[model samples]
Target: MNYAIAYVVYNPTVEQIERINEISFGHPVYVYDNSETISELPYNKDIVLVRNGRNDGIAVGLNILLETASGDGRSHIITMDQDSLIDDHFIKKLISLAGVDDREIIVAPMHHTGDITYDKDLVGKSSQKLYVLTTMTSGNLLNVQFAIDVGKFEEKYFIDYVDHEFCLRANRKGYKVVISKDLKMEHSLGHSEQKFSLLSLEFVPTFHAPVRRIYMTRNRSDVWRKYFAIYPRWVLRDFMRFNKELLGIVVFEDNKLIKVYSIVAGFYLFIMNRWGKAELRYLVNGAKK
Candidate 1:
């Protein structure tokens, strides 16, 4: 399958650049840099870099990649984050798995470092393919035409839940999200911390700053509101996940009061249908209150 490899970078390290170049060996690569100022990259014929003057967030950058792939007549596109590491044949593996089913619009590899387990009951022991509720953008091979058909990533989401929203949209359109349990790649979720709560026992949550917490909460709520009616079981499961996360933030994280405030503010924005980046000054000033 002739496919394009793309990475959305934001002030990436030399190690990340080198790793991407290595993994993307023979395929054409599109690098969308969302840094404040463009940085020069080492010359490589297989690599094409585009620098957005300012950070337009992940959703926008991904759309740019999809456009490039579609315009070049590529059938599929593998999207990756700057820090994600994959083998040279990662795309080939995903493509092979995708060949089993025509409805499989997205095929993702399992993460080596993050949550690697999928619901066993939902997948069963007989199958290597696990139909999941959602899959992250990184390390996933996307059918370009199907992705565009599902309306691409939600730009309003800006940063968080971009992948989840896309997967849910695809599912609604009868496209399957299949994960190859055998295929795994090195990827990191975020700066996570292990926290022990007296009430809930043990928990490890990805530690996000107050501002990022706002985006996470807001986007999550937005997605929940949109899909809860259609996918009640999945939505309820996600609701439980959110509550657990909120409890962890309240009981275990620092700046508890402000983080709680951000969560509330995020809900408020979601209820009002407000999207995009929240004003930092307002959050800071409100924190003083």
Candidate 2:
């Protein structure tokens, strides 16, 4: 139950730093900063802060934190986003649920952010836990050994879909991804707005920049291709979800043409087997728009 807390931060806010100090009372907290400039951390002996001069993406930062935690003889590491808020008993609840399933390699808490929620069916089904394909990175308790065996998070995915890629890899390795309905946390996904059609309502996510859209589109395609045969149902579900998001961007969001172009460019890059940071033209054009 003595797990280390790890989070990758990029230009984090003061409240985030304070929350990290608060939740990491008796555990060692590793802070991997991907900001362009280093900032001062709270004066806590249990908190280990590492500064990367530039943004290396969440996967690389998380892997670094995992390596550091492993070297410190930690068996489990709880990975979270910088802005997420956890309950005071979050770790204790997660540890309890972890003991119920020996095959569980990653235990995720129910995430609530605005109107967005993960695992809606499992929300009040506290007595009935379910095996899921994937969950978000924040508020997920990862088994250190299982992570290492699965080769850690994929660095090629700069940000978007990094967690999904890890979860899919975990599933392929015969590791169970469990959802704890009883445990919940407050987390934010993106700046979303509600848009209404004649018969339905959709939340348009316009918060992410064009660069992030490129990553989301590209990484999603790569992940789908990798696991489509083994997880056809899940892949199909995601395909529909991707189309819905595209519709939202096209219909409800501003700078619609640029985002559509970025999405198309992302798919094109994926078809060409390209990865890593997007081209400068994409970023430049997006910025101009």
Candidate 3:
């Protein structure tokens, strides 16, 4: 299957530009950059930038990249985030994973959030063959037609839980979503705190900003409602993890009042069947911050 490299960026920085440059391949790198102001990204032959001067959402940018690449006759696309760093070896592994039994799969690397330091004893589990219920958007070598068949992205999500919803839908249809146990990628989840470093792996708590907490809570609730019956293990595990983060915010993090309120507003919106682009300036009670 023919493959292409693509990533989406918003308000990219110099370091991010350098990171994107590191992933360049034989093909022209496709970029869906929705930087708020027109960015200073190069308009060279090696890069194809799709700067529409809007922050519609991550989902819109990703779908545009996927459709554009597929329309250009590519069989697979390795969608990545601008902040993610990769090398020749990582690209080769993704290419190889795409050739692993053509039975519709979205192969992703083991995401190592930049903050946690894994112990040496955790090395052998790299080959554990992890077939997860969902994987993140970054570090994925997604099959083009398979994604389109799964009904493209759920644009209503806009940002959070988009990948989870897509992966769950595909999993229900007997399609595979495998995270590469051997390959590791430098990915940032949130403000991470090392929880533990043993038990064959590690755990890190991601403390997101209050605004992000709202999107995550809302989208998580929406996706949970959509797929809880088909994937209770995933739903239950993730719910506990989310509550853990919430508890952390209440006890440790700042902006306690607003963050907790954001979660409540998010859940309230979900119950009220309201969706798309969350209002960022006020609470559910119409009080401005």
The alpha-carbon lDDT assigned to residue 218 of candidate 2 equals: 93
Please give, for residues 1-289, the per-residue lDDT of candidate 1 as tens digits. 8788889988887788787777657667888888886456552557877775788889999998998899989988889898777776776677677656787788888765443345721422236877877877898888998989899999987798999888888988998888787898776656764446466455666767777778888999888889998777777877877888788887777778888888888888898888876765638734432
Cα-based TM-score, every candidate? 0.90, 0.90, 0.86
Backbone clashes in candidate 3 total: 0
User: Which digits, one per residue and each the tens of the lDDT, describe model 2 over residues 137-217?
Assistant: 998889888899999998988889999889888888988888776777876666654445623765646566777788899
- Clashing pairs in model 2, backbone N/Cα/C closer than 3 A: none
Residue range 1-289, candidate 3, lDDT tens digits = 5778888887888777766765564545788887778657554457777887777788888788889988889888888887787777788877787656555468888777653233311212235446666778887999888888888888887788998898888877777777777788877787675564443533465767666777888999988888888777678877877876776676667678888888888898788877777875535433232
Model 3, CA-based lDDT: 0.74
Task: Give each model's whole-structure lDDT.
Answer: 0.78, 0.78, 0.74
Show the lowest summed lDDT stretch of 10 residues, model 1: 116-125
Q: Which stretches of candidate 2 lie over 4 Å from their true place?
A: 40-45, 113-126, 193-195, 198-201, 204-206
- Model 1: residues >4 Å from true position, as ranges? 40-45, 112-117, 120-126, 193-197, 283-289
How much does candidate 1 score in TM-score? Answer: 0.90
